[model samples]
Target: MEYIQVLELFAGLGGLHIAVNNQKDANIQVVKSFEINVNAVKTYQENFGHDVVSNRNILSLSTEELFRQNVNAIFMSPPCQPFTRLGKKLDVNDDRCNAFHHVLKLLPRSPNIQYLLIENVYGFESSKMRDTMLEILQSCGFYTIEFLLSPTDFGVPNSRLRYYLLARKNKKFTFCKHDHTSIVKEFPYCTCRVKSLNDQASICSNCQREVNTNISSLVQQNAGNAAQNSLVNPGKLHSYLDKETDIEQYAVPDKILLRYGNILDLRTFQDSSSCCFTKGYTHLVEGSGSVLVCSRSVTIEEAYKVYNEFKDTDSEAALKSLRKLKIRYFTPKEVERIMCFPDNYTWPKDISDKTKYKLLGNSVNVHVVTLLVALLLHS
Candidate 1:
């Protein structure tokens, strides 16, 4: 009657917890989730209806007590700030990385841990912390498999490349010590890229009506029977799109346009891909993400005509002439849909829109996580 007891550390918004809970295996249960972000904790509780221990920071968590509880598995996505390319490469020196370091130490203290999964941003695999991580896992007698995977490879349109390490205790996982390059992971099926409105209208030779590449179409390419099989194509991305979303509120403000206006990413209703979004997606518009435009897709060259005209003028002035594009921010619901959260997934009603964007940015891909869970647990 042994059940799977897991500790989800640095569990932001319970993304890992949700994935584990979604596993078909009836024995798996999250024993404790450690999170310090109050907003994330609240959002996790709202959606999960479970209590998480957040009394102290992760480093302060009582691992000695956890050992007594016989926790067998650990799933962690510790802070990526110290390892991210966007920030200074402080690695283990950064205070944010201390929690992850503490977890590494906690593992030896908790000997019963047989399975471990760690995820982080792309740059994490190359950072000095990675070597330390590999050393710790090896010394702990855990066979480790590492890979860099993106949601796009799994038939989800978004491009978010992250690092993952799966390790099992006392397992003969084969690996060459000299080989350190990460392989770009791929799935069995890759879907057709969703063509944007302008790209479709302008490039398509057929004058007839086109399909509004919805979620099913995006997933249908790869998943003949997603309900029964094919972990990659979890075909429900469009379910969470807000039918009555406030377009104006999500629209980028004029001030935002002044700095980041020209770099618009007008995705057609049928588009299947997008750039990685960050916590500052709302505030930092340029490299953060693409927006959905309601009007005919104007080529960047065409938009540049308007942009060049108002390069010196206010961004609002430039936008005045470019109103036909009908640009708007991807609604929070849409963002959630892109992240592959279930349609019924709910966040705190009172949370700020910025917070919503941040939460979604910080969260992991549900499909990707679920697939990894199924593979590792064989559920």
Candidate 2:
């Protein structure tokens, strides 16, 4: 009945908090969470209790004060904009990185914290800040493991490739068979098996060839390829979708569909993969995420073919053809499901859809982090 007390920083919508609290095998509690964005704090408070998250800037918090809370672990998904490809690669010089840099300065002073998990964009591993963090962690007597992983590597249908660094104070990772310095692409363990749609008793043939069935080997390479890694068996989008009464509100406007319809990443009812959903999910079309075709009757290829035919034709004909596909943005609820937030996760009634998308976009994938937390806390 021992509980592991956790402290979460940059706690956006409590993604890392949810991941920590949901570990069934471990009795854990998120003692405190720090977030600066008011909308994010409001969303976190709505889903978790009101007392959980504090609207405090991490740079302002004293390590001595934080350590006094006696938290055994710290989990953070610092702002990735500074390291993301879409932003200026400012690295440590980015003013946004100041808070994370402050935390690094505090780490050496907090001797009570045993476990640390940091989540960031793919580019973070190569950053100067990463180098500095590693130098500090090594000086503090911690064994560290880094990963470049995606939700698709697990059972989630979306591809959100992220960098994670796990550090244990004076202890090696329970599953660290590979070099700690090397970035592991797949989960260190594999218990997922996608059952054959055709044969209930057999694993899918594609998975059979690509995924290693052996767990002791600690390898699950290329499990992120949703189309090819049928072994990982990321289920289709239908399971995550909501039964909306007024679906048109979420549909791509006629103007957008006519202008960007051909470029839209469209997924049919049966498709297992989707692009990374950004804060610009509903607003930006090309790379934000995939738009779902509402009809089960229409295949993705069919929708694409129609768009192809209309690509060069008159605008009126293009508009008519696109509407038939019934393509729409994924609802916020659907986005939450794919992000691996639990069924009970909620937002305040006052939060607009745009704010919801923005907060969720800034969050982490719960299922992926949950598994990583479990491994980090293994004693």
Candidate 3:
């Protein structure tokens, strides 16, 4: 049996590795993985093995060295901070971007590589780096297709809109519904399409609030002004959560709940959506992610009513009222589930929760990447 050899760059937590392993129809093997972060390298080794992943800096890899691997495909999620909206918007100028730039330099010379996939924050589509990348790939006789997709497009409840570029040497993308020039929101002819709660109605039962406008704007800009028609049913949050667990440690602090509780996105077990969880998840307040209301007994509607009643009148009393809902942060394991990591994926026991959150936040959505991997190989 011939196996597809893949090289993973910026392979933090091995998201692409997991995706390759999930392919049942294709014999895909990740021959090598490169990541610079030591802690991430440790976690990758824990789940995968020491032989596959390397902590060697990507910029140091020579074209000859990459060629020696004889990989047919490449998967990469480059340093997103340089391209994220909240960052300096350095594009190709940021020091952190040097590694990806180096890879662009290597690609033209490394003829063994045929299929290539690159993932980054949504802002990357408009960057100079993207322009340079396309130029290089085109020079190498590769046909490329771009996408700005979210996990929701693949039936996962999490909304992590990312930019993806898929290129294959000498072969054009043949998706029947899409042209190569346009960035797509959903996979062609995907069967799991369902309307996003925000698209159809509000995320809350009583609130008329819309989805985060920042994310909505991103979707509009990258998807060529087409409104998101592809959505997911989300099924239930319960599927991603533990059946039962002690809740004391996971409870939101009273001070935090009182100060920013009204603004925090609240999700219930029965509901099907969540905000994107970032590296600042537990440490930051707004834009981090949604907090889970652990109990179905205290309806989210009722919780809002309590906030309105005493929110301005008595701060301490509002804290007491909100506390009744048993609101808490999602466990790291739950975040992994939301990110669509396999049940067998594990972290080193010595890794702190903070480190776990950071690594997972920096990682890719496994389900989304898995489908992309399969599509690229089969194409």
Candidate 4:
């Protein structure tokens, strides 16, 4: 069988690379990846062990190199800042948006590329970038389908809603006959997300009811099934916790526990699930995401007593001794598990915890893209 050769753009730490490799398809090979982040490149190399990751700016990516690789599939998750609501909607004006334009310029020169998959923040669907990308793909002879999807929709605990586009050239090796305009595929009904207790027998992460259909069971059951299983199985928040962890490090800071405690997305070990973990996760708790409550053996009285003493002192130094019986940020490794990366996935030992979190935040949910890759193969 001829191998499916792929090129990854904005390949942050090889999320797409991992997806292509993980996909249960026939003989898939990622020929090249273009990324500018040094740390991300190192991590990608560690995970994928491929020298094909180029440190060169994608804006300067050579079409000849892509052609040389004889690439048939293109997988990209471009920077989303220019189209995000939190950032200035600079669109084409933003220098960050230039990389996407560069990709458009490369497409015409690489007509052999049969499959194109692109992902971005949800806001991208309504932005100028969406219109421009659609136009370019259509002019280049491809039919496209778009959607808004979340990892939860596929059964992972975390909810990371993203916009995606899947495009293909028609069988005649010319323009797809399925109209030049974009076809927005209605997202499938997500039965996998944890919901209110009344909605189903399955335990709701938010409501903590006994479930005949357990979230953890759903994950395990789907894990071994073929690509058709669609593991979007609903699971508990604690479904992601590593079997063991260093509680001392991830424990909530005394300062944060004291002031913004109530607003924090704190969940006990058995809670149904967590919020979306953004790049601002540890830095900001409000809407930035969830923290798992530790199951330490300390008494509630002692924990509160320690908290009060730490609060009374009102100093960073006092916080050093403030050991609560509960709560910690989901470790970077745990986050990786939640995102469906393999157990063996590792990074450089020198990489900081902050960079680890940032890389995961910047990366795609591999399982989601894996399903998309399967679709690209079968479609």
lDDT winner among the candidates?
3
Deviation of model 2 at 91, angstroms: 1.1
Better of 3 and 4 by lDDT: 3
The residue pairs that clash in candidate 1, if any, are none
CA lDDT, every prediction?
0.68, 0.77, 0.78, 0.71
Q: Order of all candidates by lDDT, from best down to worst?
A: 3, 2, 4, 1
Residues 1-379 of candidate 2 have per-residue lDDT tens digits of 6567889999989988877765655678899999999989888888788887999889888977777788978899988988888889999899999999888888788888878999998899899989998999998888999999888776678889999988888787756467678888877554354433334433334344322232211113222222223324667877777866356888889889888877889886677878888998888887788888877665656656777777677677767777888888888888888888876888889999999888888889887787677677763
Ranking by TM-score: 2, 3, 1, 4
Q: Candidate 4 at residue 368, lDDT?
A: 76
The top-ranked prediction according to TM-score is 2
How far does residue 358 in candidate 3 sit from its true spot (Å)? Answer: 0.8
Query: Residue 215: error of model 2 in Å?
Result: 11
Root-mean-square deviation of every model: 8.2, 5.1, 8.4, 7.2
Error of 1 at 361 (Å): 1.5
Comparison by lDDT, 2 against 4, better one: 2
Candidate 2 total steric clashes? 0
lDDT of 1 at 308: 66
Residue 363 CA displacement from its true place in model 1, Å: 1.4
> lDDT tens digits, residues 241-309, model 4?
788888878888877877765477766666545777777778877877788767557544465565556
Kindly list the per-residue Cα lDDT of model 3 for residues 184-291, writing each as its tens digit.
766653322232424544342222223332233323322210123235344467778877766788888888888888788889887667899999988898888889
